[model samples]
Target: MSKRPYSAANPSPDKTAKATVDAVKDITISEKASDEKKDDESKKDEKKDDKEVSNFVMPNYLDGSFHWSYERLASAALIPLISTQVIYGAHPVLDGVLGLVLPLHLHIGFDSCITDYFPARNYPRANKYMAWGLKATSAAVIWGCFEFNTNDVGITELIQRTLTA
Candidate 1:
């Protein structure tokens, strides 16, 4: 066996022996503390489960269900928009509609993702900031699309040229 390092705290052989015993006691105490912590967490989860069903409130017209319908409608609208572009080729009106619809669709999809990942219940501040940021970005995107359609060759023509090139 290797010689044990002497410390000022454990000066004598008896004290050194006592220190080893204390170390063993500490390990058991730490294990018990961890077990207690786990039990507390489980209790919290049980309480959460018990209180899962909350009292119903009056449905606000501006809730997620309202937005969910809009999301579906936007998605449905895209199929016809895309089909028209592919079948009839590009038109200024079609490009304008596509520009508006596509960004709105993308914004709604990303908003849903942000709401799912950064939920207001868990991350209130982050969720609020993210929602605001998404709004600002979506506004900017719509503006840029409007400028492109008006000032440039428009979205559908750009895509057609890009793909052909």
Candidate 2:
């Protein structure tokens, strides 16, 4: 029997091998392009999510505003606090102001610490009531200290005597 000459219809082993390699290279290139497209899409999605998060505002549950301005005022009050403490017994007015303000400052600082650790998001109703109760208690304490300063031997004097003794 005579062997048929290789034609377009019947590729030789060499041609078939080259065709297979070329097909694989094309498939690999296409797959790499698709992967790069997917990566670009994911990066765009991440940027969108980041923008949304930045624009989002946390809902306020409290009745009144705790403005950033108040925080600045609280920070400024620290100067007087340190000055009064150092002087200890400069004047009756300073002692009385210290008596009221010191407790308030302490309460605000403590409440902030508590709020940071035990956020309102965790227990909405409980957190609101807890914060209100803390504020009420702080007010009462401040009032009592102020009264004590007015009625008794000023707060600084009392503390100094106690510390010395």
Per-residue CA lDDT of model 1 for 1-165, tens digit only, reads 977677896487988789899999999999999999999999999898778756566666347886788899999999999999988888889888988999999999999998889988999999999999999999999999999999999888898899999
Clashes of 2: 0
Where model 1 places Cα greater than 4 Å from the true spot, the runs are: 1-63
Q: Taking the tens digit of each residue's C-alpha lDDT, what string does model 2 give over 1-165?
A: 987799999988889999999999999999999999999999999999999988967646343256344555777876877576667554677777777667767776777766777788897787788888888889898888888878888777777889889
Which runs in model 2 stand beyond 4 Å of their true positions? 1-69, 88-90
Q: TM-scores of the models, in the given order?
A: 0.62, 0.53
Q: Predict model 2's lDDT versus the native.
A: 0.77
The root-mean-square deviation over C-alpha atoms between each candidate and the true structure, in angstroms, is 11.6, 7.2
Cα lDDT, all candidates:
0.90, 0.77
Relative to the true structure, candidate 1 reaches a TM of: 0.62
Superposed Cα deviation of residue 163, candidate 2 (Å) = 1.7
lDDT of 1 at 51: 82
